[model samples]
Target: MSPGDGNDDDLYGGTGQTRTRLPDGGQGDMYGGAARRPARSSSRSLITVVGVVVLLVAAIAFANRGNSSSDDGDAKKPDTSPTAPTGTKAVTSGFAHDKQGAQSAAANYAVQLGSAEMFNKAQRDRILQEVITPSRVTGFEDTLDKAYSPEFNTNVGLNKDGSSPQGYTFVSRTTPIGTKATGYSASTANVAVWCSGLLGMAGENSKNPVTNSWFTISMKLEWTGGDWKIVTHSQKDGPAPVPGDERASSSDEIANAVEGYGGFTYAR
Candidate 1:
């Protein structure tokens, strides 16, 4: 049941010792022609019955302990390896070279779009302008600005300035699983990013708890303004796996880690 609700006492009902007195009637007389058979069991029979019971109890205890240990151990293991890319490089690279550069670009862009800074209007605008087509950049910035308004920030427990409260850490980190270019042309590409993200806050007395989500983000990329710029992008939920054994990191640790690690600019 619901993790850590087991007890040894419940397993072996009361104490190991049980006193069952047989009735002094027909069954007793059938064995010894007396209204009551001797109150005492023969030493041999008593030992035999006790031995059988002890063996049964021991077997049950061993089985329960083994099962419990297995469950506990399984809960602590982490699943960190990335999953295989569903689409082949050949399928993705119709126009561009099916080499490291395209892969790297897709990966880097995915990370940038998935960063925590994307939730801030000013930061998001700068990122969008840097990573999107010049023609579509204004529209993207406007849409995102509207999405991350004061009410949305408040709902996510961020201050009016979009900063986390002191001692609290907001987490929004994405790990790319794989990149696929669905359609590629000489100057444009449609890239799909399969990713996993940790989103929410972690801290003592924090209202929000850290949570994981899996999603696929697809972007229509145009080679404009000296780089690949996203013209359009969309996201859909996961092909996620079962949870793993890593101990939950505290809010302060999560915050420190995020600040310490610098994000990448991908090209492949």
Candidate 2:
């Protein structure tokens, strides 16, 4: 059930959807026949939950560290590049034509393909144009068009039109932990990106509250059109770790955190 596999049921297991895990709090199951209202809690509880989340984030950073080597000191050097691409464009391009470039391209492609924007046809097409090889765009589009059907949209707690409900916000984002490039050549490369993602609906009564998952995306990239573009890609679950003891946040708290935080642009 890799991304672009065209099996709607496996969408989340593959790449685009999030598998909802029922928490201690009574949260509804969006696809489990009937929906239940989320349990309510006070802001103090939310603040405590936020503190737990921060700790979990720190743990993730620690887990993602590359293995030590003779160049461990070099690895510890801070990245000088901006956290994001320096432009007003929605997606960045002009990657270097090398292994590092291919890794960067693959990481960014994973983010775009895993984004909530992929649910909307127009935005999806635009993203494909930017990140996918031109010749493969139609094939990818055809696959995703079927994969992101109305029923599929509803199952993920979005409108049939792939829009968020009036009071709900759909969340889909991918953060690359690291990337490795192998089978590199002047014109092509293979890159695998270790990623952590957040996906689901965020609202007071969201049937599917946002949850996180870890997976790796393997991409085949070609240096085409003066930039590295995805020829094809697939995803497999984990490299996931055991759950931490952190308390799950309320739907409102999760929603607020997503809105307050911005994402980074990953590179090797």
Candidate 3:
């Protein structure tokens, strides 16, 4: 549930933090019911398995042959007409005008603040300058600089200087599940973003493994110079669901997923 003042009443309830509980070892690897070992297979059983595999392979090939002609990507193209404007710029001030736009602004800002870029001084400064209001930039920079101290860096498996550790890829990302405008006006807006996040070091046999978390961040946005700019923000524990018993992917898989998938430029 959202961690607001019961703003989105239909969806929220009492909350500190809620998590979907997965099995101890892994979520994906959990076995339902009894665990049983397969019996030794005879030559005939082996032959049967091979036959099944061949049929499955043939079916997969047939499916792939038809997929190219069936262009799902084209069907999923977003509407870019004026009525439903998809903001072209990653961030442009003086553009967002409604509650939807305010939600979009909060979502994008959440992504930027929780990004891996925020760990680096230069990139963090750029993001602050772009996403935050002018009045808050100096204070935000000072607070963040102190919070991302050398000890904090070491704890998160980064170098003392806030750089990614050599031979290791650091991962930090926040993905908004959905957003709500708790309050809105032409000059001011309050938005809450429900988010799922991941943070940790991704490396083969790394000591610090990646972790997933859920939280809600509420931003008080003000119209300054035109676009929505963050004035203040706060986060609270989530309304998590019970985790499933599924096996967690390997470190290599995690790293590959992080590297291969590009993040979206969020819009309402």
Candidate 4:
């Protein structure tokens, strides 16, 4: 199916978090704005990093692959990896002071940065406060305020004010598949998180049906205020896997699943 239409490049990208190099050797617009609107193709291509979703797909495939020995030879084993669920909201603190800590921070920050809440002004401000480096919070807030404008909201299937319509739910969630620390020092680090994402409006006859995307987010973090806080971040499209043959769910099913399932606080 179509991944919806229009200039919602910011909706998928850093959500005003990533920086890009412009044609004139200027910095990229974090999200789509008038300054960047005329360069739609180039800007969107630079910033439209896809988001993520649930991990049950592989598990379900393993369980239902059948018992035939012929198929068994090719059947993959189920992933039995242990998870590091925090049992807390994504707005967490007190991460360790090492490379692992940087990975953990990147994972959690990806969740908040890519959430539906980021589309709303108040919630967005609150998120910036929690995840952004103290010295950079004001700058992030200013850039994002203009990034998530009413026009941007409407383009992405939300109301002009960035709220879901009465009967629909706007979904924008990110799930980190894994994280890696690329650079590390005593007080600074760079990490990348491979993630899967889900976005769109879920409801009957919804033009923007919830869809999946794959992307990687790269973040530069610093040990600030006793915890890792984002200094800057950027995203790129993939290392995506091949699509499976499973039938897509109905809009109602997608909506129900989103409501029923709560998000996680990720760790390295």
lDDT of each: 0.43, 0.56, 0.52, 0.56
Tell me the tens digit of each residue's lDDT in model 4 across 184-260. 99899998888776666667766555556666777779998788988776666667777775666766777777665
TM-score per prediction, in order, is 0.59, 0.71, 0.67, 0.70
Question: Which parts of model 3 have CA positions greater than 4 angstroms off?
Answer: 1-89, 92-94
Give the alpha carbon lDDT tens digit for every residue of 25-133 in model 3.
Answer: 3233222234321121121121111110000000000000111232334324323321111222344344458888789788767676666666567766776777677
User: Which of 1 and 4 is the better model by lDDT?
Assistant: 4
Where in model 1 is the C-alpha error above 4 Å?
1-102, 259-262, 265-268
Error of 2 at 129 (Å): 0.6
Q: Candidate 4, 117: how far from true, in Å?
A: 0.5
Q: Cα deviation in Å at residue 162, candidate 4? A: 1.0
Per-residue CA lDDT of candidate 1, range 1-268, in tens?
A: 0001222122111133111222233221122222221222221122111111100000000000111122333223222211111111111112133333344455555555555566556656655555556676665555445545677555555686767777766655556788887887767777776766555554555545445555565666766544565565555545666666466565566556655543322223
Q: What is the C-alpha RMSD of each candidate to the true structure, in Å?
A: 27.0, 11.0, 16.3, 14.0
lDDT tens digits, residues 77-155, model 2? 3322212222223234777788887887777677666666666778667766777788877766776666567986776
Q: Output the TM-score of candidate 3.
A: 0.67
Give the number of the best model, judged by TM-score. 2
